[model samples]
Target: MKQPLLRYPKALVLLFTVLACLSLRTVTAQEIRIVTEELPPYNMTLNGQLTGMSTEVVQAVLKEIGVQASIQSMPWARAYDIALNAENVLIYSILRTPQRELLFKWVGPVAPTHWHLFAKPGSQIQLNSLDDARQYQTATVKQDAGEQYLQSKGFTVGKNLQPSNKYTYNYEKLKSGRVDLWIANELNALYLVRQAGDDPTETLVSALSLPDLGGDNGQNMAFSLKTPDALVERFRQGLQAIRSDGRYAAIAQKWL
Candidate 1:
């Protein structure tokens, strides 16, 4: 009468085993969480869509690597904090400063960023050189790469105008005369001007040309230190594929 007849519920056992396998796979599949601020022509939402140069470039790489990503549009500070403190998180199109170099795994020089200074129409603040603009009050996003760059260069930022969560505020500051100099990438400045329905003829934007800052071009994507090396390699391979296949160039042409 040994165990000739007592088979445990085979169907139930199989169901449990299947569910466990699925759970394991779900846990193992590489996932990267993204947090981004509203940096326009790069990560801004147009008509509620997250369509920008960096956004699209990243999406293409992610698709090629077969990893899924969840993007949250939030303040840049919050986003950077999340990437710094959380696992499997990344910040994108960020400048690769020496201080931040060891902080995260990095990828991509997606495109060049030409740092420019904008002025209101008919304003007499002339910048014959980067040194010339230091005398005037400049408006910039708090703790942003640009701010850090200017501050490092001994550019005095007066009144520290309201923190800009998006590029649009630069236009507002220029229009209201709240800031004598507004620093931004040229393409983004153009996007802001276009959004205001103003032609370039109505306003003047000049390149500040920080030679030290200009070389890197500020086009980098970064992943949290917590993200696995295997996934990072996947991202690298995917990036290479896109670059070799001309996908990256196409994306750039669309926006830049």
Candidate 2:
């Protein structure tokens, strides 16, 4: 005779399995997919471990909400793609631009970031307006806000915009005189230059301010459209809980 457990109806077993996967009370770490990019101070790999301001906040939120998830760092384009189309996918430290407003359900304004166009120290690239930057070649990461913003401003690839897959490559290209400018966030510019053993004040100059990407919700934790509203709300509340208890501030103080 079959064991008591096997004797149960197959339909009942499937119902329990479905509930385990779908119900937040029984959701496992592997059920939700978290994705991010190597955006330093926000999200990055340090000594082979993933730990950053936004990463910490996300971890705290998961703990508060009684859920578990592992974060995977990848290229920004790939990470954005996954978060845009995949079910139950979470993306973090992403700029909440107007173009991306409705793309994902948001949680927290993890941190504020300032956008600017950076040029080499003593560079003659003076830009009073975005149109004045039309003649210059700017280095940008593929699918990054910089590239997207430039594209919206009529900067064509292979002409005025040079898009690469890695943020580090932009620095290399700028130093090599291959690109006249590189648009990036203030924190990212400083962190990358410092990481490269160069002083940002001496190596990079802010040529232009990108006000369009600034103001509110500079970066946020977001869930794909396919994710259930309840799950998103749970995370939203979890984030709020961390903020109220000073956990979020602690993480920010540690990194920023």
Candidate 3:
């Protein structure tokens, strides 16, 4: 009877174990690595600082989860590869395509976007279908979402006209007749045309109807395939928290 009086409840021990596991979870959640391409209005560096709608939204989510993230900006292919093969890595604001579905664990719609086809102002390229521009040499940022979409469908790419790196150069190529078509996000296409000192109206001709290109509007925050499922769950929860709290909309409005 005296020994029984000193016994600790089994329930208490289980509760203690659960609490310890949660503490460990919190500690492990702090490390998140984000790899991104310079897709402006989404993820990009401004004035030597990370600033953009997608970047802001991600930061907000990480803050809520008490997580620390390092965002690496690189070529689209490079970023995708990192998120695919590297540990604790993720890629941002990417269009969710079928071909890319099994590569990583995804989180987001931090924002929505539409793809646009850009051509020189004088060009009479009508977009009755994606095939309409088949005759013209389409240029795209190498390994970009747009490029991947068209290339997957057997469209012959003209040259690697990387955009986020330098839109002015691509614009010049378009003007000089080096590239017949350029695929870009609608908002970004407009921004680049204006930035290049070209009449957004007279220099770049966008297709009347933007195409879906088979992806979610904004892109998902993707965790490397090799990441632990538990960690992926935490990231997914973090993203949901932002969306549910309306923080996602607030940050997205800053860019859109």
Each prediction's RMSD over C-alphas, in Å, is 7.1, 5.6, 4.1
Segments in model 1 whose C-alpha atoms lie over 4 Å from true places: 1-31, 156-162, 214-217
Clashing pairs in 2: none
- Candidate 1 lDDT by residue in tens digits, 91-140: 87687776677888986666677776777767877777877877777778
What lDDT score goes with residue 249 in model 1? Answer: 88
Evaluate model 1: give its TM-score: 0.81
Model 3 residue 148 distance off true place after TM-score fit, in angstroms:
1.2
User: Candidate 2, residue 94: CA error in Å?
Assistant: 0.7
Q: Compose the digit string of candidate 3's lDDT tens values, residues 1-256.
A: 3455237588678888798768646645565578787777677677888878878877887788777767788877777777878777767877787777787787656667777778887677777777776777666776667877777777754333334334445667777888777787777677767766777888877754455653345566777887767677776888899888888878766776
TM-score preference between candidates 1 and 3, better one? 3
Better of 1 and 2 by TM-score: 2
Q: How accurate is candidate 3 locally (lDDT)?
A: 0.72
Q: Per-model C-alpha lDDT, please?
A: 0.73, 0.87, 0.72
| Deviation in Å, model 2, residue 218 alpha carbon | 0.4
Superposed by TM-score, candidate 2 places the C-alpha of residue 197 at a distance from the truth, in angstroms, of 0.9
lDDT of 2 by residue, 109-153 (tens): 887789999999888888999999899999999887788888988
